[model samples]
Target: MNLELGKILFTAAIADAVSNSKDFSAFVCQSIEKHKTCNWGDCDPEDSHQNDLSFESGGRILSVYKNPAAHEDSEPKIWIITEWDRSITTVLYPSDY
Candidate 1:
């Protein structure tokens, strides 16, 4: 059965990426714009040269439910995700995960 993530805003936001920083936010935004789905492998690169950021870092999280009706498409959303330990947590705007 398909599960609904409840009342969570599944929006995309671009986080600040510094030089040599693992830019998971960038990946999330790119993935959402490209696939409309969030997966760890979405940003994974098989080659070291192509490698930059991995979704495993928990930096970029998928919003739980679809965007709220009042929320405009141009607005970014926040989401709750099940972490490695099977716990629900909120990702802060400036958080790495």
Candidate 2:
């Protein structure tokens, strides 16, 4: 699957961690791959308003959802978020709507 980084708002410490850890990057990639096969209901069953999908890999949690900025009638753009532990969550854009 194709993946792209969005408006990344990482803290300095998290930035350092990302730069220093190849494993984290790999986990993020794996998460994206997992996101490809995930159905909307995979993340939460009752939360039907948002079609966010999530999966776990290498002790990290990753999610993919529709980009809020995209128009309702336009082609969908997917946003990816990888949570490395509890403190760091990286957001990405897989495609532009």
Candidate 3:
């Protein structure tokens, strides 16, 4: 099911990147669509479980999306988090968290 994203937010660094880079901005937009539609990107099994539960349990939801060009062992490219109350959703780089 497609979920509500509530108020969307971005950290300064992410906002800057999006504003400055068209490719990255498109990726972020697509990632957000995936997130709201429950695709959950590259999140682990545990996070997948939590995301599923959050749909019914009113828990926080987390989605991790990776940059295919980045090293597999590197930190995630982005993290999208929707608050438990669904009052807000944020898109940020992991380091920005």
Candidate 4:
């Protein structure tokens, strides 16, 4: 899939985190690439299916990526979402939701 992500945005907290860590910056970049390619990161079957459906419906596209463990494993850090109109894509921690 060749999805075009419009202007990408992120929360201020995300900005701060990305700015402070090269590893996190790389993770964010790689996650975005996967999102645009329809990889959908670590989203479950239903969500991945929704992302696929979103292409035709122009509905919101959501991708969740597991962040490396700070305390516990399997924490979702990248809650990347592209709006229905594709006018904007946002990246943020799930806690920010």
Among these predictions, the greatest lDDT belongs to 3
| Residues 49-89 of candidate 2: C-alpha lDDT, one tens digit per residue | 23232233223444555433344653233344534343344
**TM-score per candidate:** 0.23, 0.33, 0.90, 0.89
Roughly what TM-score does model 1 have, to 2 decimal places? Answer: 0.23
Would you list the C-alpha lDDT of every candidate in the order shown?
0.32, 0.41, 0.88, 0.85
Model 3 residue 58 lDDT score: 90
Which stretches of model 1 miss by more than 4 angstroms? 1-65, 71-76, 91-97
Taking the tens digit of each residue's C-alpha lDDT, what string does model 4 give over 10-64?
A: 8987898889778888889999999999889888999899899997788999999
Q: Candidate 1 vs candidate 2: which has greater lDDT?
A: 2
Counting clashing residue pairs in each candidate, in order, gives 1, 0, 0, 0
Give me candidate 2's TM-score against the actual structure. 0.33
Q: Across residues 19-92, which tens digit of lDDT does each residue of candidate 3 receive?
A: 97777788899999999999999999998998999988898999999865444554448999999999899999
* Candidates ranked, most accurate by lDDT first: 3, 4, 2, 1
* Model 3 residue 49 CA deviation in Å: 0.8
Clashing pairs in 1: 10-63
